[model samples]
Each structure stands twice: as structure tokens, then as C-alpha cells.
Target: MLFPLFFMLMFPVECLTDLIEPITGGVCGIMTPEQYSEDLYMEDEILSSVSLSIKESGLNDVSIAPGYGRLLTMLATVSKAGSILEIGALGGYSGVCLARGMKEGGRLISLELKEDNAALARRNLELAGFGRGTEYMVGPALDSLKQLESRGERFDFFLIDADKENYPVYLEYAIRLAKPGAIIAGDNTLLRGRTLNPDKNGPSVLAMRKFNDMIATDERLISTMLPAYDGLALAVVK
Candidate 1:
């Protein structure tokens, strides 16, 4: 029981890291993991600015990995997403990244459970120049999703990074909330690579396996899972 809980919280089940084996581990070509991260962050002004805010605000453990932040920003920018929904708003780290890639006049709705975290995200988002285009909701994410559904809200892109146990349910809701071309990207799909080995079965692992299988098998979604930090599941609504 303890192991499962630890596994779930050990990494952001919301968004996985970029797949670099380790700083001293084998190569993914010629670059080390640390080097890859450095290259990606070299001229990344948006992340640099947001990271400074995160440090100053003491949102230390809340943001996504820098490499993953760049990936999220690229997904949003390349998709030209007009509306974005993020299931977790950890100090607004991922929110800032997602918002930076939004089309002009785009809006981002970030849902966080803790009011204090929500407040912190609001501040960080403001510092990142996304205060006007983002809304922070404080509540159980499922309740917030219901409210959004009631409001007839739809999104072009989704970033799921909340509880590991609820990932599949969130995937269901995300599919319902997405437009045809919408993209549903989930973090920590690898569950620390436990999803690949059945012997390592645990609640979180089982749940993630179910979620990944759903994405892969669902006829409505065309999906692929990338081997990033842990894993990233990208599914497009067909």
C-alpha cells in the first residue's frame, strides 16, 4: 500500500519528464540527459522567466521538468490551441508553459485542488504575463470538470496531471470535452516503467495500464505513447 502511494506521488502523474536515461547513463545518440535538458533550455526565455518566478515564490517541487515544459509549450503552440484545459495547476508552472503557446486571445483553464496552490499559481501566472488569459479553479478536479461540462465548455488541448488513480476517468472526461481534432496528453503514463512489467503490479500501475490501454484501443482516438521522462501519452480525438 505504501509503495503504491509512494509511486503515485514520486513523479507528476500529470506530465512525464523528457526521456534522457540519466546524467551519467547511456546516450540517446551523443548527448547526455543533462546535456539534452541544457540544449532545450538554452534560449528558452519563457521557461527561464517562469522558473525564476517559481523559485522566488517557493513553488519548488510543483513545476514540471524543464524539458517537459518545453515539450508542452511546443504541443500547444504547434496545435494553435484556442482553448486549453489543464487538470493540475502546480504553482502554475505547466499552466504558464501551456499559456505561452496559446493563440492570440486564447484562454487556459487550470484546475487545482488546494486554494493556496491556486493562489500561488495565480501569482506565478501573472508574473508570466498570462494573468489575463488564464483562470484558476480551486476544487476537486472532477467537480470542476463537471462544472465545465455544464457550461458547455470544449477544449482543443488537454494536459492531465492530477491523481494517478483517476487518470482513466479523466481521460474519459477529456475525450468528452475535446473537439474532433483535440489532443489529450497525459503525463506519467509509464508509472516509473512499472506499466511495462506485470510483476510490478500495484494500484497505480494497474490504473495507468488501463488508461494507456484505453487510449491505444479506443476507436475515437488515434494515440501514441512517447518514452519521455517516465512516459507521455498523446491521443488525438478522431
Candidate 2:
């Protein structure tokens, strides 16, 4: 039968694992693709709800990847962030993750360029049980940052995932708005690897390159670039 042949062909899976183990230095020992997938999408009920909300709101195109969400959550948790500011609020997926990772009574403020996206994010945040400690502001992120600055608001963490052309400006504003020892993160820093090609690099890539260079050279911060999930740039203020 076809099933018997298929089982026989797949039966010696451990042999493949053993072969790869030495090559990978025992990293993924005997784990199948399915197991790897489970590891990648390590979500509980709230994260699942946030993901479902993003899908239902038709915001999959702008939603953060699961791995990126986990990274944000881990950073928030590690920092014990009391005040988080997010530059983009697409469907509230990342906001929910950050809020969930915050210390008890911590607050998150998200800025969205579109009113509809802001509403969608507010709804999604409420659905994800972040209705209490989150706020969605509809405006240009730079303008919102100015307002927050005028109001003397300082954040413990900042997440920048908005228009790429303004990444450097965002970093400047984030630096101004950050508290001492705050963590700032920027998404999509690699721009699909176009930053390397001078002729091919567009405004976004060039701006991101400038942003990366600034962070790397800044004496006031410690920073690193993560190669995964389209490149994440993280900096800690001194």
C-alpha cells in the first residue's frame, strides 16, 4: 500500500537527525519541522487572541511576525518596563505582547497614523485583555512624540515600527523621550537587505543605514542588531 511505503520512507527520521546533529552541533536534535514550528510560535491564550484579532481585522500585511512579537515581549519583561511607547499600532498585535509582558500596572501608549488603524488597535487591545493599561493615539508619530515630550513624559521602553523614511528622526525622538537606562528597538532595520547596495537602496534603506550607523556609534547607548525577522535594532540608553 502507499501508506506502508510512506511509513517505511519516513521511519528512519532519527538517522536524519543524527546526521544533522553533528553539523548543527546538537542544536535541534531529532526535532521535526513541526516541533520547530511549535517552538517558533510559542503563544499562550492571549497571544493567540491577539493574532486572531489581527487576522480578523485584515491587518496581516502589517502584523508583526510571531518571532518578533516574542522578542518584544521578552524585552519588555526583562526591562520590567513601566512605561512603553510604540510608534506604530497596526491591529495592536505588538501592543498586546508588550502590555502582557509589562510589570503590573505598567502602561503602554501606541501611536498610529490612521484613525481606522487606531480604532482597530484599541478594539484588538481590549479583546486581548489590555484595555486598561494601553492607549492608542491617532496622529503622526513625530508629532505625538513632541506632545509627549512637552508633557514631560518619559518611557522605559520604545518600539519603532513606523515609516522607514523617518527611522532616524524616530530614533532621535526616542532618545529624547527615553528615561535613563531605557531600551529602544526598531523593526525592519535591514529593509530586505537593500541597505547594502548603494544603487538599489531607496530612501528607506538609506535612512535605515544612517539610523544603524548612528546607533552603533552613539556613546550614550549600547546597541546591537539582530539578524532575524527582517533585522531588529536594539539600544539601551546610558
The predictions' CA RMSDs to the true structure, in order, are 9.7, 7.0
Q: How many residue pairs clash in each candidate?
A: 4, 0
Q: Which runs of model 2 end up more than 4 angstroms from their true locations?
A: 1-41
Q: Per-prediction TM-score, please?
A: 0.81, 0.81
Predicted candidate 2 versus true structure: per-residue lDDT over 7-79, tens digit per residue: 6576476656555445632333555443465586777787677667767767655666667788889989989
Candidate 2 residue pairs in clash (backbone atoms < 3 Å): none
Note the Cα lDDT for every prediction shown. 0.84, 0.84
Question: Which stretches in model 1 have alpha-carbon errors above 4 Å?
Answer: 1-34, 43-62
Query: Lowest summed-lDDT stretch of 10 residues in model 2?
Result: 19-28
**Cα miss at 199, model 1 (Å)?**
2.8
